[model samples]
Target: MADASHTSYLPPILIFCAGAVIAVPLFRRLGQSAVLGYLAAGIAIGPSVLALVNDPDAIRGTAEIGVVLLLFLVGLELQPSRLYSMRKDILGAGLAQMALSATAIGLVGWKFGLSVGGAIAVGLALALSATSIALQVLEERGDGSETYGRRTFSILLFQDISIAPALALLPLLATTGAQNHSGAPALAGLGLALLAVALLVLVGRYLLNPFFRILASTGAKDVMTAAALLIVLGAAMLMERVGLSMAMGAFLAGVLLADSHFRHELEADIEPFRGVLLGLFFMAVGMSLDLQLVFDNALLLALAAPLLVAFKIVVAATILRVSCSSSTEAIRAGALLSPAGEFAFVLLPLGAALGLLNTQQAALATSLAALSMLIGPVAAKLIDLWLSRRAGPAETMEEDFEGAGGSVMVIGFGRFGQVVTQALLLQHIPVTIIDSNVERIRSASKFGFRIYYGDGTRLDVLRAAGAGKAKIICICIDNREAALRIVEMARAEFPSARLHVRAYDRVHAIELMKADVDFQMRETFESALGFGRVTLESLGLSYDEASLVIDSVRDRDAQRMEIQYHEGIAAGIQKVPRVSPEPLVQPKAKSKALTEETREVIEDGGAEVAVGGVGEPER
Candidate 1:
């Protein structure tokens, strides 16, 4: 009997597995988003389609756990300090997105004949962009930590948090408050929610680390995985108890463990489950989408989904603009978050229960939410395509590297590259020079230089530039990102060639070192040090004295770069001082006279540097 009971589930499991295996790879090959694949798969196998899996609600409960796990993993990535830095985006941009999106959408709902309360409920529900889908897209593109990614995430986080309030607000919005719906219940629920968060924080701070420590001592990998799930589910359950989303609870749990030593272990344990379940969640959402309702109200949905998406885009883009985002960021974010989020499923039903919306209105709203999610990925893709078209293509010149493959291949013709080529030529070594700049190439040819025109970032260009035959490749591009892109490409394309790169700054130097290049030097580093040495010599110091000071500073900088390579720039600030602590002369014997110029440098010693490298963020 037990064997038979378990055997009955295999058919559905097999179907789900088959759908994913066939559809996911196909969608990927077709250059479509995997989220779209899962959704398509779900709709195909759902009750509304082939009817292989008749009850979407059955699987939805389990698939939702994927969302919880995803949030927990997201939390692990954010340190408290990083989250704190996004406070403005969370409150300013996030709040503005909600207000404007809801208002615009609400007006549309009112025009469609919904009661004022129903329209407000509808607007609020649709305003919340699908967190699961947006996060999945960001994760796929590896943009979660980027400014645009962070900004989008901030709004999503705020939306997740606002669900509880939206729920409480529903009763108040209802024209008929039969159950004596009042502010007291809302205030009480808020208190309980706060208390739950406090409890989670307390457990995270005092108990989780010690518990994990005890668990780790047992050498039980399986138990650690179990514990990871336990914490995620436990956090989710707690938040659900207070009418908050389980995903939000998991996120809070993750943030609590962010500073813990076990974070990586927990993350590693949770990753596999997160991926599978997230896929399942996407599929379940597709299955849950009522295609019949969509067909029943075809014209209504057709107008609603696109108009609603447009409203959301306008509101989000406008908010991002006001919040000081770049035009590109604002545009991407507006489109990225235009889809109605999963919370609509929860809120629309709750509104109906509170009499804020009738059954028909609730169903229509739910259908609209799901339809927006289906359209979200498509919308984002279209926006990207449009942006790409607007930006146009980069200029390129014809590649010709005949009779090339010299001992050294120099891959830039900028000021930095020109200087590097001069040094190589000074050594009497034959060099193959390449640059994609048409004007630069034209000018170099006029100067009797054989500078081949080619984009260093392209693999074919590198091969044509004699990268395969060259013993050394010198990358001296001014763009930090381009430099890194070339570094990765050259390393992969020409493993035999030793790479020497010109980095932009300390951050670039660190990245280049991390890439394991044979040699990397900051373009400004030596020049700046030389300038300082000369300035010291000019200010009443002997050449030897100035040289000694320069050497010490260079030594300190070397130590700082070593630390930055290991633990980022923040960890290097105190370890490596800009100036040596020891006086030029022994303090015990004679007090050394410090110049006013030297003292000024000492006063402004340490400063926080940008991660973008060379005065701009690479992202």
Candidate 2:
């Protein structure tokens, strides 16, 4: 009987793994978020459906690890400098979002007959949005660097930070006779919490690094992996013992390691675990969702979920509208952040345990939160559709390009092309900007910038932009194949126009060079070089010395490109040579102060090392 009991537990594990393996890929192929797939899988196999898993508590206990690791990974990304750089967004936007959403939701709850404290706890919990869902959606849409993405992330970061306080406040809000505690005890608990946090920070700053260093020297991959898990688990245990959330401790540990040399290695070791565990956590949430309660209160559930989501959306959009310049961006932020977060699962239960919420109320809130998550991606899609409809007229306004002609024709006015156009315009140089993005063109016009809307790859658009008369044509589009095609067309037709192409990478650069464009720049090459120069300066090099080093490196790199170009041709690569244009800028005089070793390092494509003196070249 004991053997049979142990064997019966295996089915649930098998069912969960199999469900994830099948569901995630299917959802991804359908262009839906993988997170939805996990949730669906859980609901399908859970008690509400097939009831494949008999013991949800057992699975949930294990799934909690996922949340811990997820927080840790998030902490790793939040480097102190990066956080400081976005302080306005995090502290300002984040705080305002939490406060406003909580108060608004709290008032609504109070109207529904909840006690003030209970209402406030619920409001605070619902105020937070899902970080994992928002980030995954933004990344998939390739908008993580856009204005909306930044605003959404700032709000999410603040929500993550607020989790600790929210967890702490739940017990105080509880009015249960058994759970009553004095004000003095609460103050003592607060002090102990602060001390625990300080201890974590102190250990992370001084002790954790050396501990990992010793483990790293052992040079065993498994050993290192073990140590990484040990640290995370140890920190988690420490926090649990101190009456704080384990996830918070894990996040603090992650932040401490954010600047460490072993950060990438730690991330690699921990990523797979985090992914699987987080998936399990989502599934556990799905299993816990009582479908019978949802069915019984169908009308209430339907109304409550939408109302909650709409309230949050209004709060988020209003905040963005006040803080940002674009209405479309505000709308996007609202849609992206409307969903209830994973932490809601944690908060609702804690509320129930502390008697801040009865079991029935907690069940209602859980179903509502789950339903909101289901609506998140769909809301984002609808928002996109609305934006597209709003921008329809702007897309058809390309007739304005008929009279547009200049000495410089700039194609694809994205982030890169915008910079080039702004610089030229600032110098009082006449240029025509062309882009296919209707919204961008419309927005630029609002800012008093003249932008022509058209597809630059079409020859008609090029002719319309006066490519024949233009002395310089800058192709700053992101598509490598499209950039090459435009280069070929311009060479075939307007050979007199000097073509400058932006390459996505080294291979793209080689392709452009072979296509015989007059000039080619690897998109991020200069920016990376600039970053390296900044690093040298931070390490105590004078500005002039850093500048000299960058110049030397740049010259050597240019020479290498030239060699690669000829070598490819010699190796029977296709050639598309154009009439060579005159050099735009003369090279600066070479420095003669470098010793032989330094020159060898430069030529050999190695970094310069300071030997005896600070900022001095190596011997």
Candidate 3:
């Protein structure tokens, strides 16, 4: 017979999984975030509602490991070079926001009858935005590479790095924490914590790679995954034993391996565990909320949650605006990041332990954080409404590709795409053109062309437009990033279709080649070469001679690109012969010429010429 304790645990596990699976999708479908879903699910199953789980404490210890894993992943991504490159944004905007917000919030907390230490804890706790939720939302919207997205990420990253010192500060801030207990024991613990950090750095630098290599050679993926967890937990346990937060240790371990060869593999191995545990952490926090306390103080909380969100949004927007971001960008960052995050769950308890806050205060703060998180999605919706107004009717128009299918599917209907469609039409080949710009579609329709409204970066739109059946996919979008995304999606989802892309530049062309595209050409490459050939003809060369010059230049360029693709972009620079840096057409004289290209002044008649130079040619 199985142990009774073991059997009793099954129901809660089943309930937790079911709650997450159902609630997350439902919330997402409603245009809400997944973080909100997890919290609501926790509330439904906790004693506050269904009473399926009477004790949230049972899961809190386990859920905290999720944070440890989160920090590890964060550290893995912050390679030294990347960190250095982003130091300005991280330290400037990120650091400044944290300092200012904490100071502002701390003042408020202090004014409300809290002790100095309690105010400090509350200030820092509330100042942190949820890194997981904000980043996930940005990725979902496909804006992680945008300017505002990058700035948001930088601020969130700095918040994450702040966790270590914040955790360490809690104990010292406690009424009878480190200082009251200061003796041989405290000294020993401090020494041990330092020793643990040193040990972790040494193991990660000298031993971890070789250890993973052996595990890999055994050809058992499970063993490699097990090893990754061991390293994460081992470091965490060491830190916990030495009076430091587990998250601190895990972060150190990850930083050690950030530049290691196995960095990606470690991430791939740990991601599943990180994702599930992180979800579990949020749910656990939700379950821990004292719904009775919230009900009792409903009036206070009702005022506080929205006020907190509004203040945070105002603070964040102010900081971003000063950093030269546009109003839309500032508001978006403010709305998405204006929430007290997972750190509050950790810091509040620590604050309680250190006599900074009582149990009721801690619970109240937790309730406030949860309520603020709930308001975040609604705030995001409002920002969308605001941005849509500014986006103009042409671009903000909805996508409708009904009955839009053809043998050849073109992703964009801009200048390049319009010309490409004409050539395809010249061959009597039926083609379907899709673009996100409604105004462009209207203009094309007037020209006897039928272009549907769609975004190629979206797979569903591509499918609805009949890309699955099309023999070829032409990515002609002016946005290089969007075109690359389509190329990747086509390779994965429409493997049967040949991909031909309009590269934005040489770098874009190389990236397409690396993505294994069937054909790609720089948008201006051939046209520019043709123009130069005609230019040479006008300068006195025969057509054949001009063609030879163009051919030679094209050949040299192709060779340079080949070198760039095989080696590096800098390697291609060696192919260009060094020459004098003076204008070839203006050896020793200044000449008066057209500063601007002349356009027609009369219908079907050229503009009258004005020549003031000694070398002016006869008209």
Per-candidate local distance difference test:
0.76, 0.77, 0.76
- TM for every model, in the order presented, reads 0.68, 0.64, 0.68
> Which candidate gets the maximum lDDT versus the true structure?
2
- For 1-619, candidate 3 gives per-residue lDDT tens digits of 4799789889988988998998999988988878889889888888888888877567676468767877788787777755765788899889988998889888988898788888898899988888877877886665675778878888988998898888877766663444546556545666777787888888788988898788889999889778777887888888888889888888887887776666655665666576577678777767877789999999999998899888888888888999899998998988878888778878888899878988877788878887887787678767866786788542445667777778899989888898889989999987989887767888778978888876677667788899888998999988776686678668867889988889887767776777678888877777766776678679865555555455555555666667666686444333332111121122232223312321122222221122112473211
Clashing pairs in 2: none
What's model 2's TM-score?
0.64
- Report the lDDT of model 2 for residue 512: 76
Question: Once all C-alphas are superposed, what RMSD does model 3 give against the true structure?
Answer: 9.6
**Could you list the CA RMSD of all candidates, in the order they appear?**
9.7, 16.2, 9.6
Better of 2 and 3 by TM-score: 3
How well is each residue in 185-255 modelled by candidate 2, as lDDT tens digits? 66677788889889888888888778878888888879877877787788888888877778878887788
Off by over 4 Å in 2: 1-9, 175-180, 272-274, 388-619
- Look at candidate 3 and give me any clashing residue pairs: none
The pairs that clash in candidate 1 are 129-341, 130-341, 612-617
